[model samples]
Target: MDRLKALAFTTSLLALVYFFTQTKFTLSSIQWPTSLFGGKQQPDFSMYKSLSTLSVQEFPLDPAQSRRTVIIGDIHGMNNSLSSLLDVLDYHPGSDVLIHVGDIIAKGPHEGSMTVLSYMASHNITGIRGNHDQKVIEWRGWLDWLHRFPDGRKWLTALERRWDEAAAGGADPGVWASKQMKRHRSPWWRTIPKDWKIFTEHYKIARAMSDAEYRYLLSLPLVLHIPHAHTFVVHAGLLSSDPRYKPRDPRQPLARVPTVFGSAKSKHGSDVPKLRRAQELALLSDIEQNTDPWVKLNMRGVLKNHDVTRGKDGRPWSDIWNRDMSRCGGFEHDLSFDDAHTTPNKHKMLPCHPSTVVYGHAASRGLDIKRWTVGLDAGCVYGRKLSGLVLGRHKHNDLKKHQSPTPTDIPFGDNFTGHVVDTECQLE
Candidate 1:
């Protein structure tokens, strides 16, 4: 019996040695054994809400009453560039509303992110969460989780000290993380791929973040709906309709269309009612509830199968969005094979209102402006221009040349126009 016990102990020690020496392990590769429970696990979103709304009441759209709504694109911690851009715009505090389209931090100078976060917090600036922002949030959450345990607190303190040393020595965080992963031999690190090593910077930023900065990131939603501007601001593009719905013939008219403007007479010639506010909000909410949160943060295109993908191989979501927005009603007749094949619908397409989406995250395309959609990510981190879409009653004649004219089909009625403005950024 004593011999048997000794043999089992020897086998366990050998297994541990094999795992530590032969395997490429890291702390991040740990996974919960949910598969053993025999059911798929749903993502926990209790910590954050997916959607938020902003109205003209909070941010007045009138130029006489307020300056303008300056919606900036993927900042990527270019604080200096951001200041310069604001200077060029002649931004007025308490008068003008500033909104970031996300990717606010990461991929730039470390101090720049903290500076940007401090500035945003002080100024009450609000925006949607980007993919990079999400990564930082996850890291911060992990750090918070670790802080609850005695050993974890020690482990984190050591990790932070090591990071500080790496920074002081001018070592790249990605290189440092790679070395640390190998040295630590934690099973979690083995699951990470080489390309994802860039996330090491994200981890560093997360750990360095102040409580205020972390809360600011946590407060941001995946989508921000502005009722008065008839615009939806999101980190990435939004689908025109539910992907599950079948495609309708663009040529067909709706069975029942909502009235956009009321005919009530006002002091000014006629009273143009709110722009289908209810329908637009419902549409926004529907998309938010149905689509995966990750899709809102990373999607660039939609596949023919109606699945949203981060890859550029699929059809540009903006194109489909513009096509769908141009039409106000649903199809009356059954869709033909040609119609179905040409459109991005696996199920029936419903009526759509002429709503606009102001988004970032697609820096590769850079400064996409359409009648119904505006993509403001101009790759500022890559030394390209940092873009902003200014929407208000005030018109900048200089920016007119850059602005896409509102489509004749849509009735915006001169309440506001979206003008694209940008400034050059320095290479990080």
Candidate 2:
């Protein structure tokens, strides 16, 4: 009986060895069953990837175009407020170019994000990606990757099931996770934290998104340049220029100015002069290349040392930008021999053009309107006001006067005038 049992065990061991050797099974080789997850084929991961930095989109400056340019601030999923603000602007679809200043979706109502996204997509509106939008994109990307593997799908399903169970029991998922960690005493439990529920909404939003919506989010750039308006639209703020590199001659084309005179070709451009169009192209190229992607999305201050901070540690970047824009160009200032010696970097102290930057991430400041920078975020998600900067060719008299008390008329391009219009938001 013992010999027979040993034979059977040896046979089973041989069978197992044969199965592994013949099949060559591996985690990578396992195919996720499509039927398990809506029967949809795996999507091309690259199709939904977001650009890190230097993604720029420029609109042609048509002199004859009478369309108004409306730059709106952070919506933060306050779709009702957004709609009311547009109504207040008397927005005309064919005659107005709508540009959002990021944070269009997230944090307000449950359906507000998708509603705003759908509206923007249908209207052909464009804008930069906000920090919140980035988080949603990341979650979607993670979910997409996980859905490509059977085990990953199972894990996500289990998490969802657990979340549902916790919700049904009227228990906080974070608290429940803490208890599980204590009971299990396993390293895997550590992966689930007490604050995991904070990201649950983002995960839910990502999962509920359609392909078109996901694609739209992925298409958003870090910086949007409006050449004719002499404006840049970003989520947060931008530095004037890199302090490490000596300033260039504002009088000459950016491409012709060398980093260090006679050292080598300019990092910005070739030694040869570029045409007006080429120069325009080089402007954003230089700025986007020098600035980090994160800085463009969250910068609030620029330290004295030229370092940027997302916190309130230094001077507001807008103040620095306005300072740079207001300075006299090197050519405008004449220096004597003694003065030149005293200010060795005098020639490098050229001023930037009075270009405008419309940004929206700093809601705490609320409706910041500077000479060269406009901050339109008015904390709409916090039951404050939704703000917008409307630029139109109509004369001040011809433009429709909005009833909103927040409207402030301001000068725009050579032929355009702008107004800061806002409406009260419903408390979430």
Candidate 3:
């Protein structure tokens, strides 16, 4: 009897504690917070895979390609800084061929910033599509996602259904997003930005591309080959010998798309075509499947093919590998967390242009200098500022002193995870 009484008392005490704990700790809703996406939930490889990989005409040379050209790094939407960098470079209308690596949109100042990119695109800046560029593309594929998730889709459809029923109609994304910010606590929920309309607008661009222009952008080679200069240019990274196999750009018009985009016989696996085209990317169901990204354009929607050689420490791919030439022999690393050397699963053409390959997809924040790697992306998206290499003759040297352009404020990665402020620091 004594034991039974004691057990009952303890049970009551424990129950009381449990009830209090539940009252104090349990949340009434499972909403995600907006801060989580500030920089955490980047786009997956599948995002990049969705964008139509583009290829274009033989780079005419800098008098066509330039005496040299200015190859800038990735700009995750840091628009203000991007403008400053352009100013410092003394960038004129046709003096140089600008190779923008990628990540031009999505993060940072994606707002009025469209005007900048649109201007460049209209002028034929040769902007290579980055992974961020693809995330929006992937989002397009899932346009009806709001009506897809179990709870989310149901809630959305409920509202829309109700409106549709009365012919009142459509939920405003801004209002919905504001509510999400206020109510969501899920980590994934926070990844959205306050100005998500930028996504819709960008989609409109891709969706509305003139049949010719759309095909042209889609036809852009994953790598830009400047043969006269012996230079190769890509948004992220490249291998030595590019694959001769070419797919017609699935974009509109489709007449101009080329079969083979660039120089052949690369050392690395950068020549793989899977990650370079939009049609190929759509083939994938998820991002984690593409672990080894030979080149990643955006964190989201990136579809990559692991460079088998990338797993090897020294002298990665033999195709793009030049026993004599140096730069980009191994996989890229991730320093944000464990500093583990995680290689991407995508690839691009190699021996771009020719000898002096200009690139902007690879960031140098983690690895100081990757082996045999000549990365031009200076991580301008993370508030670190932007950088661009000038393939031009220097005033000091008549024999072509490679002119290094001053970093510009292209505003590529400013709001990488929707963490932008009203304004950011100027690079100049």
Candidate with top TM-score is 2
User: Candidate 3, residues 324-404: lDDT per residue as tens digits?
Assistant: 133221212111121223434212211111133345544533212232334556556556657665444323222212333
What's model 2's lDDT at 345?
63
Q: For residues 390-422, could you state the per-residue lDDT of candidate 1 as single tens digits?
A: 666455642334432332122231246556668
Question: In model 2, which residue pairs have backbone atoms overlapping below 3 Å?
Answer: none
lDDT of 2 at 226: 59
**Lowest lDDT 10-residue stretch of candidate 2:** 48-57
Task: Please give the clash total of every predicted structure, in order.
Answer: 8, 0, 95
Candidates in order: C-alpha RMSD to true structure: 9.1, 6.8, 17.5
The CA lDDT at 154 in model 1 is: 64
> Model 1 misses residue 173 by how many Å?
5.1
In model 3, which regions exceed 4 Å deviation? 1-68, 141-219, 240-356, 364-373, 396-428
TM-score of each: 0.72, 0.74, 0.43
